[model samples]
Target chain A: MAVEITVKGEVMTALLSGEIDHHSAAGMREKIDSAIDSNMPSLLVLDFGGVSFMDSSGIGLVMGRYRTLQKLGANLHITGASPQIEKVMKLAGMNRLATIN
Target chain B: MKIVNKFNMSLYARSANEGFARSCISAFASQLDPTLEELNDIKTAVSEAVTNCIVHAYKEKLGKIYITAEIIEGGILRIKIRDTGCGIENIELALTPLYTTVGGERAGLGFAVMQSFMDSIKVSSKVGKGTTVTMKKKISPRITVNG
Candidate 1:
């Protein structure tokens, strides 16, 4: 999936499309890491409305991001996830780590 | 019996999981009314289990991972994933939600994901020997479409 970033003040929004699996993790890591480092956003929002499929690869990616944000004491939110993607997000207990909208 | 005619593959721990196992599994799975959704389930299950061995089981060490697949007579596909590495200290504890050796936001969802994706999942582990996971899924009946 492709990730597009929109930086709004201290909040960075990540718009994702396609599938988020192992194949897509590298790109995600690079994009999210760069956004976090360069923007130093107070919050990171992952928008998954356009994503068609996701699996544990997506979970691992989000968890890695959550860890990075945790270390920085920043907030994270996920929005617009499809039912399948949302099922995975909820299964990963992302609700405890980040806001789900 | 054709039980012995199954597909056997043994791959190095480092190379086995690079998403290759998942791809192979998808290739071998029956295509009766199968969709991208079924393929995703199989891939995700294979990815999580194989990844556990590659990323967590060996940790910093090197080892081998074994994967076997068989298509049964009743349209059931069985996959076995095995690794010879440090086993779980406590199988029950390890399977607990929110518990993971990786820590630091691991979220302990690998097993959960595997369980959710596969029709049936079984795990066996020995303290210092290794862990084995058996997953089974059945192919749906054929669908007919006409103009």
Candidate 2:
């Protein structure tokens, strides 16, 4: 999996690609967490446009980041999710925690 | 009338192999010509089962994950994902949503996801032995109109 982060003022967007599974979740979490810590962004947007496949691990990745960002007084938003990815997120009830578009 | 097609594969229970195993099963099930949603559902369920083996079964060391896919009559797809590593002591608790034993790392939705995607699921495991997850989904035949 590949994750690229971009900072625009207080909003940090993480563009994720490849399949998001258990193995990739750890690395993606660390990368996003480090970015959140260093930048202290007011809003974090997870871009899932490039992600082809995702399982429950993706839900954990989003939930973990939401918790981390909440601690830093930041908001988490998810964008660019494919229909499949969005369904998984919805199934896991992640929509209740974060804004998905 | 009989089992139309079937395949059995074994791979190292590594996190990286989870995707590979999922693809293999999805491809094998493709013969039934499932829709994109159906295919994605099957793949996601397969990923969850294999992931359980990698994360929970062989926590400290790498082991093996066994997978079997078969298409019987009436376009029913049956998939079995098994691991010979440490099995679950409480299957009921394991099936509970958001009840993970691995302390904050897992979302505890593996079996739930599998259950949602497949038509039926049967889990049998023995503590200190292994776990076998069998899931079945019926694929409907696609229709084509004459031009």
lDDT of each: 0.79, 0.92
lDDT string for model 2 (A28-87, tens) is 998988898899999999999899999999999998888888898899999999988988
TM-score of model 2 vs. true structure:
0.98
Report the error of model 1 at residue B29, Å.
1.1
DockQ top scorer:
2
The per-candidate TM-score of the B chain, in the order shown, comes to 0.88, 0.96
In the range B77-147, model 2's lDDT, one tens digit per residue, is: 99999999899999998999888989766888999999988999999999889999999999999898899
lDDT by residue for model 1 over B1-147, one digit each (tens)? 244236878888873255677778878874434566677678778877887887678878888889998877766778999998998778777777666777533457778888877799888998789999899877776667898
Best TM-score goes to which candidate?
A: 2
- Per-model TM-score versus the true fold: 0.79, 0.98
For candidate 1, the docking band is acceptable
List CA RMSD, all candidates: 3.6, 1.0
Pairs that collide, model 2: none
Error of 2 at A52 (Å): 0.4
Candidate 2, after superposition: displacement of residue B88 in Å?
1.3
lDDT of 1 by residue, A3-45 (tens): 8999989889999987676556668779889989999888999
CA shift of B43, model 2, Å: 0.5
